[model samples]
Target: MLKPISTPTRELVNLDGVWRFAIDSRAGAEPWTGLLGTPLEAAVPASYNDLFVDPEIRDHVGWVYYQREVRVPRGWGGERVLLRFDAATHAAKVYVDDELAGEHVGGYLPFDVDITDRVAAGERFRLTVAVSGDLSNETIPPGKIEVGMNGKKKQTYFHDFYNYAGLARSVWLHSEPKTRIADVTVVTGFEGATGSVDWTVVTDGVDEARVRVSLSDAAGAPVATGQGASGSLTVPDVTLWQPGAAYLYELTVELLDEGDSVIDSYPVAVGVRTVEVRGHEFLINGEPFYFTGFGKHEDTAVRGKGHDDAYLVHDFQLMEWSGANSFRTSHYPYAEEVLDFADRHGIVVVDETAAVGLNMGVVGGMTGTPPFPTFSEQYAGAATQAAHAEHLRALITRDKNHASVVMWCIANEPASNEEGALEYFTPLVELARELDPTRPLTYAMVMFATFKNDRIIELFDVVSLNRYYGWYIATGDLATAETYLHGDIQGWIDRTGKPIMMTEYGADTQPGVHSVWDQAWTEEYQVDYLAMNHRVFDRFPQFIGEQVWNFADFATSNGIHRVEGNKKGVFTRDRKPKAAAWALRARWRGLEGRKPGSDGSTGAGSGEVTGADGADG
Candidate 1:
């Protein structure tokens, strides 16, 4: 016999308005000390840059201190108070009433601290958070070494991206009952289309509980139901979800005590989609669809990565208008709002983990000391590898319900020559399969180093090649580049039956700049580059898709090719559209009614033809 589940009423306190802010140099500085008597001002979502008018002060790097006072509800005395941060860069030390509370390391992931113990009922509690902006080395995965900007004789390599260090995402206070659901795990299968949900319910009393699970469709119609013990429930005949026609199913789990009185209930939304790679073609619901898109960075000109909801909505609209049906959350996992937008907009997402820059190498130079010994150990130790596998499992478990996510990218541009990479990636691939067998696992392979290991390629369901041919290799030779790209992909297809996706390809363009010399900075050059790739894309049916190098021009600390960052966006950093925007729109809008593989198929009226043409520098 099972117990009925009860749902708790959740109240969200909007901590968005302004609070008091100050900059401190000391490591353990506590803002709560004088906060109670000091005057309070607007501080919500404000950046350190907002305070300084001087250029030097604006760019100064150190610790920024933020403080706020919130009154706990009189009736919410027994309830648990959770302080949640959507994101905090680098490192953060949280304090309540001058008492040290908790600390967090990673900048991108969401974390919360139980601050109930530190807060008094019906009284205003002072909360202070000190965040360090010291990015001397990449603390996260995919760490890099670079030449230090301070003009030190020694060269340093670091991760690329603007260090918009602060509370770049959001902060909130949530209150929940003592007896509630701690976490839930939902897994789907294709065999008879069954779904299972494991619930970890927390309670105070030793009363036996019953759980009732029900499934609903997008229209809120009941499709399946089941009853089970307090721990878990399995529902069968689940509706299979697919991209483009993403049909989401809602699961409601209710808890009841021994008296059969409902105590708490919780609901989670999930999509049942099966993804598989079969020899150079990706199958979604047993059909084929081309994945044309770009790599995304969570950066803007003014806001850096601290963008709001409107920014995300505009970015997605640009992708959809540009004929991009897919996007890679490049180098790291994006904020939850970004993923949520991707879900509703019907965009295919390759949810990449924050595991890039782990192995930074110099051309013709010997292997140097790696950044962050933690990552190095994780790459080398079996136990650490197992821990990384669990980290990936948590990521998958948290995001598996999203229909937009079709693939899980384990690592980005890891060292192909290093033996540790092979050892580390093999287990990750297996772990991804073990956790969620519904989706395929993939890693971005450097084009020049693909031949080093045939065994590594075997583990991936789809073979993704990141080629910067015309952009980096033969910058002036388009024809030779296309020929090489075509031949290389063909050879790989012959070797591995796994589907192929040109994971990355694009040229940098200075938005709004028009050049007659080579059109490199002009929108014409951007369109020409895509037109050339489309020619090759039309010839290769085995290639599943091509994601452009980037979706927007992002801030990079490391400048390459005399550019501060990769200026490869079809739009500027400020979300302004380039001339190439409409050109891409014309191409993706049903190929402009031109037959596939037909010469002069480009609808831009630029007289560009579909063929391999050589150009002299």
Candidate 2:
């Protein structure tokens, strides 16, 4: 008889306390091994700035070593022990008991290393991890600065966010049975307005496992159930989930043996909706709904990249209040909690990969002396392209089952004209279709819309353009901006006859300031900009939806336009709503005949219609 699958309780071993930290300044130094009496005390999951205020500490860029001692539980014997890092910037090399455990790259995603073989049960062991953020490492993605040397063509990124390098997220010790469920992928489909759930389970075990998958409504009542072998199962007659009528169904999958003893269980909230690009217009369940949202960066002023559920929820409320129905995870994949909230709140998402091809010069046509040697073997060559492709693949595969995700964007502002860029992009688009055919494929095109490269647009199910109408080109020239935007988009529609979305459009507004030198900082200007866009939006039959340039104020190291940062969000950096919020809410609510306080009070639940947790007033 098999054990019934049970939900694994996450017991967090807080590694946030003080840990021994030191900077390794020597070039190519072996992993620090010398034992010292007492080291500089620094908190785990804290930045170097949190402990010291030296300008050198702030500007210093290199490897930082952290050491700590932990005792393995005696009861944890025979179980597979895993060390999970919520996040570590750049590169992390982990060692246990002087044995090299593993290394991981990429700062946003979660990674774990199995330490069962490296450490004995009930034994005290010293764990050392060295983290490096050397800007010269080609494997590490460029951030904040650009380096040009000897025509070896390596371009650093000039982004608008702080480079908080550390264990910026969480770390934990997870224990699981040697043979357990590995992963789960759940997908939902809506046919004729009815929904169905399909799930695939990956496991490692010799015994034949019984799998039970259950779908529940928001109130936690079982709506559908399916049972099968430890592989795949399909549940029919699921509740159709919509954007405003976001009726989410929680999915629980359990691995069990013939005896009904539980083994392991995993749960994820899922919504059921159909998204398609139909002849120039994107449709959601055959309804024409406009997208009004912003791009979001997963960073905070104080928290850095630490996962904060409350902050995420507050962001959702602010967006909904500002009349947004959709958003994009700009430049990278965001936290799972953000996506989960989107699923429940009915916010459409353009789940983008961590591939921001900002280095691609074709978008802005910024041509200069090439940075790298043209024909050199290491000329930002195929290996870099391949690494990027692999990263994109991992991102897509990791988040494929998310129902809120309406499109897969392979690269953001990539160098389209580069020799092998299209070569990399085309295969990724094909791979996205192969993995999940339900959603469309999209890439953000900037500036040039000539048909000379329409072939790239033809490969995608939907073609999107990120136009900076009045901001970058002409300020206060609303009529000209509209004419240009409408003409370019209509031309694309006439050429491809494919569905189109205005993936990005908005002006930067400095919150709390009403500037007479052009209302760039005033809420009035923000409202007028969106209102004018709505006029053009009403005329464009081919356009599906429009997501604004940003949702909230995010950290940007590169402060441009004398504005200190990208002050484009409808809300301030602290998630405070600007005066434009009310105007957007009125438009989104479509509340032509309704009066304020008609539903009773004026608080979270006082409005006639609630906006994602009844928080819009």
Candidate 3:
């Protein structure tokens, strides 16, 4: 469905900020059952784990509750009022005045329910949401709470990032006309300097509705216009969206009554570009485009995994300064505003799902041999497969219209070697193709698949590998890593004959630590690690992209091995750059006298590049 847009005729109220919060640790304690005892005030759109000081509150596994009172807009009478959540972690159940309004599974997508019949205009109602981070074997990012020797339980998952839970995104109360536009799907094509757009507009109610679609340039000049629920429009002399020179058009789809008076309208900023993969080449607008960036997470210090505006702005500026043109949403889809900003900045994205629960056996490290136990058993389970499909549908429905999303990564580092993996992924891949034929589909290959020739590689249009050779496997052995990494890339290229992209490759490094002998966790080792990988990447033309493991240090499970969080980020957790950050800047931005991989060999004798001279963009 189209995102609810605020217009003159529609009302949009943000229900963010502080809300009454409580934890329901008792079994069968339904937080939505309306008996919320004097709860503590906590910030909405943030992980509840990090907001409190109590260890129990920070480590609670069961249902966490949020309650708030909202007054419906007095002017929203006779309109279709809806409660929308940008996203809630893992699973959520919503109640309005003790009546169940909606429930949704999966933490990475938006969900809403129409409350028009449940409330009156200008009336105050109690809204409560029960958010659960509990995961079973069937759930994505599969993990379970294990009671330790000290009687303390911890959330152990296969994913490297922390499992931050709660109302992680925004919530809104939106009202539009009873008979208004429901959704709009726009597909664009480019021919020389002209652009053709095919649109499908879906609406609700029985009013005699007519749809008017208009495309305007960046300068507010009309470029193309069309009138229909499903039709095409052509704009002459269209400006194509290119890397570093992003040109966008404002697409406004309006719903009008028989009298031609507009009732509701939705405006989307669109970039006209085409993405395709042809035999080891990633073509954007018919030109090969190399991706150089990081596979990032929506993580900050105090907010946990909450989406923050300041962090977003800072991350974008840092990425641009590092000369990055793209990044995958890593293991899940990010906030909608991030994708919109990417469209504006001409940054390509490999949009992914939160379906990151494939590995259940090997927890702590990557360099382990395994027929890992199937905790989720998702490959053979029908219910898990069905849930995964629904999650994919919701994700595609939400972000399909964005121009920045060049590819769809269905899963990250799944157990491709598992018994029923073929059966599980086959239909999922087919479903993605049916949902979006315009984009390429691929999942990040884990080390298991990389070490051996896996049949699952044949299912993807583009091959993506997330190998940790030097860090996880070789343990600072770059020479041996070079051999393994090069062979792994060649195996995928020979097997699939498709363009390859290294989605995850980085080493954990303490920001201030320095070692003369290139020890692990030292800043010098991190730089050399990346530089070695780049040298190998340059040797193969089939390699189209290289996204480091993470953009910055982020919080993970409080394991015994972890110091604070995952220290693999080029920058520290607080957004300060490390030596590796400068190394990346020099290489990516092509600064004068800063040529990385000049020796094209991995050792202690590697050339040094500095980030000191890097200008803040």
Candidate 4:
């Protein structure tokens, strides 16, 4: 779907503020018919779980309601008005004045509802959105709900992240012309100094509405113009969008009527670039580019999974300060605002789907065995595969045109070692290639997926393995962990010729905890844990990157393994650096913020962090 933007023939209004909220006592209840009897005020664009003092509201297992009255602008009479939602967790059913308007499944994706016939100019109507946090084996991130002995329904999810619900992003009311540009696809490439942009425009109106497209440089000078729905535009001198330096060309598309009068005009800011995964190396613009970053989540204290600009800007600043150049959306698709910021700053991104916790075998990390098995009918069967496939399609369709996204991660730590792994994953891999072949595809593999047992690793261009050697495997024995980690990675080197990246590897360390001896959860131990992993990483030239398990500590489900939340982050949840952070800053800066690839020599003793000795934070 095309993102709603203000154009010459379009008007945009942000409908984000306090809204009347209530917990649903039963399913299929229409709260918009009358005022919700027990309505409480809640803020939009935030997860409702942590915004309340009551535990019932925080841990609710079912549906909730968010309603507000909106007025149609008087100037939007001739245009089509839309109810736009940037995101609604899991699923949302929107109603206009007590009548069902539109609905969408899958959170973290934008959708729109046409309300042109529901209200008139200068009139008011109740806009109600009923959102559900319910999940099942049929959902993207599968889960099971069971009623406890106390008769309260409890949700048991396989994923580690807390299930934050409600409108996690902004809501908007926008107006568009009768004939508007629906969507556009731009594939960019360059040869020598000249650049080529292969463009295609899709319209949603009368077939007779003519299309006109043009490209303009940074100074607003038109470089090329074409009169068609799809064609290629070439520039004499092209400035490529590099890893750290970015350049954008504004593409203006217009729809004209029979008399050559402009009816609708849409603007797109595009960056010309290309991405490829060469043998044992990931390349951008045909040059070897290393990735130095973390896997991130949209988490905060009170807001939960809410998307806030203040946190986003500060997080990027911290990443740059730490000498990081790339990041992954980890288990789910992040808000579009993040990618837009990346586009402007030229940050590499590994766009992932929310197909987390798909494996039913490893219930308690890598060693423990669960009673159930994955890729089966009772667990992640055909129904689960269908839902997972839907998310992949939606993810590519939404993020296909992004310049920052270099690859697609279909799943995180799936049970690719299971018996039916190949049968289950063969089609999904094909589907990803079918949707967008411009980028490579990979999935985060569990520790159980060995070279001998892994059935689906050969399908991917890059081998993205999430390993925990010192922390989860060896457990406080750094020397033994180093030998074990090296031997295990050597299996991959002997088996395949693919470029391998340690997508996740970290030890949970408390920020203030300090110890001279190497002790788990201490700041000093965290530093040593990272150093040992780096030693193993430098031994193999096929090891292309090392993105720590997390950018910052984040909230997770309550369990014996968690202390308040997951502490695997190098930075604290509040964005404070631990001792391990300094160790990474020193190493990555020395590597010029790129992972060691192609070079067999170990890079050490260079790019010192100077000030603090990294003994304590």
Please list the C-alpha lDDT of all candidates, in the order they appear.
0.63, 0.63, 0.79, 0.84
Give the alpha carbon lDDT tens digit for every residue of 1-617 in model 1: 01112235556576776666655633243555656333334344544453445544344466667788778777678877778877676568888877888887666667788888888668888788877655433344423234456842222324455555677777877776566555555655455666554434334343434666677777898877766644444556666665545567787766667776666667776666566776656777666667778878887655566747887888878887887788988876777777767666567899987665544432222233233332354333455455456557657866776778889988665554455666667778878888778788888765434443434777787777776656655665677667766666666666786777877777778876776654555677777776777677676566777787767787765444438566778787777777767777777777532333334221211111111111000
- Can you write out model 2's per-residue Cα lDDT over 454-500, one digit (the tens) per residue? 34676788777776655554557766666655566556656788766
Report model 3's TM-score to 2 decimal places: 0.92
Q: Comparing candidate 2 with candidate 3, which one achieves the higher lDDT?
A: 3
Model 4 pairs in collision: none
Q: lDDT order of candidates, best first?
A: 4, 3, 1, 2
How close is each model in CA RMSD to the real structure? 6.5, 8.3, 5.4, 4.9
How far out, in Å, is residue 571 in model 2?
1.8
lDDT score for residue 244 of model 1: 47
TM-score winner: 4
Cα TM-score of candidate 1? 0.83
Alpha-carbon runs more than 4 Å astray in model 4: 26-29, 364-368, 593-598, 601-617
TM-score of each: 0.83, 0.83, 0.92, 0.95
How far out, in Å, is residue 313 in model 2?
2.1
Deviation in Å, model 3, residue 89 alpha carbon? 0.6
